[model samples]
Target: MSGRPVVEVIDPGIQSTVQAWPGRTGLLAQGYFPSGPMDHLCFRASNVLVGNPPGAPALEIDKIAMSVAFLEDTQIALAGPEGIHARLNDVPVPIWETVRVRPGDVLRTANPGRPGYRLYLAVRGGLDVFEALGSAATSLITGIGGVEGRSLLRGDVLSALPRDPVSARRFPEALRPRFTTEWELEILAGPRSAPDFLTDQDWSELVSLPWRVDLNSDRVGTRLHPHRFRWANGGSIVTGGHPSNVLDDAYPVGGLLANGDVLTILGMDGNTSGGFAVIATVPHCALWKVGQVRPGRDTIRFRAVTYDEATALNRQVDFTIDPGRVQVL
Candidate 1:
């Protein structure tokens, strides 16, 4: 846990390597949104597999390819899209599972496909990056968090927290998530704008029509194609401060809102305060699923569920390692 080890970046991936903690929490305080992995559930699952606590600093890679060599032995996990080809000493490795490596091993990753955007990499003890505003998560737009609020680049040597030799074990294959399935997102009506902003037709279109993810999507907000409705209160709204549920405060991750006449799906890195009307809030459990969605190929459809049903489904999911079978290398 002391005297960090060096992790050299031989190649910077398409996107920067970002990290973040839980972020600040208080009444009437505007906290910086920690935009890390698009699929945070998988990110957290990787951390827990390697015995790291939730919210630990992990590497978040976007489309750009990356190549690095470790200075010491380490345990790591690669999760997210299919393009990421993580390797040890030039040997291919699998995603969504933990792998072991010896000192001087080289780990390289490539883009999953054209238009690819993100990848999540977690080390045994997590990366030892600086924490600002109570989080290590990077905010690219605001230029805050992660290596001076910027993306990781070539020749950057990141420090790693000391590892626990005893906890260095291979992750079971059963624990990995299937990356090749279509993603479906569930949403609830927004606290403020949902009631007064979107017309009935807009709401119906959101639930019934299939919306394609536009190439313009990013960590800030996902721009979707035009649906069949107009704003009940027009496209613009007065600026104000609100809470997670309130449109006047700041929007939270999974907040579905319209931006500049186009339907945008806001992620964790969305602005804290805005005047735009909030349409819906993607539940916590569904946030990761939404993040895994690929552009053009993915379609988002809303399904209504009762609170009890949502809770039951969330509880049914297993979030721990099975300790049953070993992952084939």
Candidate 2:
């Protein structure tokens, strides 16, 4: 408690893991995924509230009950789309603000008011965890980064770097994000998503209707229903047995894949390379919203935008809240 801050996990909850900046550059070719927080915006905001750098390591949790015991005195912040019920030592603790914690403080989190999927917790100096490929993100598929390269388990213990306390802080109401169930995503057609991949008629249908979120969705990707498309006559060759399969290639974070009859939009822990065809890529500016789209509850419709328009929206969103704390990509 004197030299380093620590937290003991009584119940790690669902899919909780320590996440930092994504894997190092040029790592995908070697099959390493940049498995950072799915909601980077909230992750950075939590760190900022604690006076830490934007990319400092933090705990990311899904919508599940969790409890932890603080073994040292420090400052911590929780940031997310909706304020979940939390208590310290049986007293209600506020969200979106840094709160001081002392030894033996029992912190519990649960009862989400909304449908979003992620909640982030950031300590003042960041979590102290092993880094793989120059990142602290935990890849559940690869078992490579974070604590033992897996999700937090019961009785797990986590620590933060030793540092003098920063001032307790909170973000103004106007700066926090409000989540919704119906999402309209602006997309940019990727290299593989040229006009010829799908017929003009199919492209129209893709943008015109709301795609249903499937229950199979997870951190790896969000599976969607009704992604079938018409192929242009002789427009392209069949890359594999399935019409959607192509030569395995690198996939962007928001790559929309035509896997069989359904589709999947890649997430933070998505594969670095795959055989499916990516019809579009979500811009970094609005990519975090993908993480909040609760499976079987929220639906999304894509709106194709020009490259210029995508860049402009990116800048606008970044400046609207805590400017200079987040990057466009």
Candidate 3:
């Protein structure tokens, strides 16, 4: 270790704290769900900018503002909305790119102009926090991960690990993600909902109609405007004991499931086991794109893509950001 204290949280803004990959298998084994961040793309982007390896722990912030002060000089980057601004000793800093800051400088966000929910802050060598299972993620639902599996509060401090000098030196020019109004999420139909409950037209409408995001949405799952659909059965499925599916049937991360009273679009932080009817799943490649949409903005539309296309797109993205560029700092 470099003997440098990682960055510490001065004010855990509106809802800011450290998160890493996630604890999935163990959580599911214990009947707990895996709840992480809403936008993994932005999270990974910040990590890459700060020269941290993929899956390294980073900070996740909600609408509320947060202030972080470094214990030592460090290189860092911010990804997500411009509303979540950063200041070094009160000097304004840009988002989506790398910048160096000295100790005692504070970073924070301003009143947001756009409809964004989360911000990710990453530093050189990643943030140092106790890992649960294999990640540092905070699963609020089960009260696991992070500082006791809860949101960061005031007066909380975080430490950092030493980074390789070579990684720190490879800092690239600041790059910001293109936030736009044109947001289209791709979905794959699967796991069938009651088999008979959904008609061809209902499934068609799901992929065709524009559905607005409900205001009561969060990291766990997003609820969309309801649409009429029929179900063959109204009973619950038995929860089984399988390596992956404890809920009896196998389902994808972004699966669209219907419970007794709600229609939810599962996101990255969805439950590991559920008896809800599964209609579809959003492709991993297109998951981050949904973060750009604001609540009550307008009904969002889903486009259906073949499994081959989804796989191809994901592979292309991985190729675009080569791990070789990640130098040890």
Best by TM-score: 2
For candidate 1, lDDT tens digit of each residue in 189-262?
Answer: 87444347677776777788777888777778777886545656543233432211224457766777765456
Cα lDDT of model 2 by residue, 80-118, tens digit: 766568899899988887889999999998856566778
Error (Å) of candidate 2 at residue 41 is: 0.3
Clashes (N, CA, C under 3 Å) per candidate:
16, 0, 14
Query: Judged by lDDT, which candidate is best?
Result: 2
Q: RMSD, model 2, all Cα superposed?
A: 3.5
Off by over 4 Å in 3: 1-4, 22-32, 82-84, 164-177, 193-195, 231-251, 296-298, 323-329
lDDT of each: 0.66, 0.79, 0.66
| Candidate 3 Cα RMSD after full superposition onto the native fold (Å) | 4.8
User: After TM-score superposition, what is the CA distance of residue 61 in candidate 1 from its true location, in Å?
Assistant: 1.3
Query: Candidate 3, after superposition: displacement of residue 255 in Å?
Result: 1.3
Q: Against the hidden true structure, what lDDT does model 2 obtain? A: 0.79
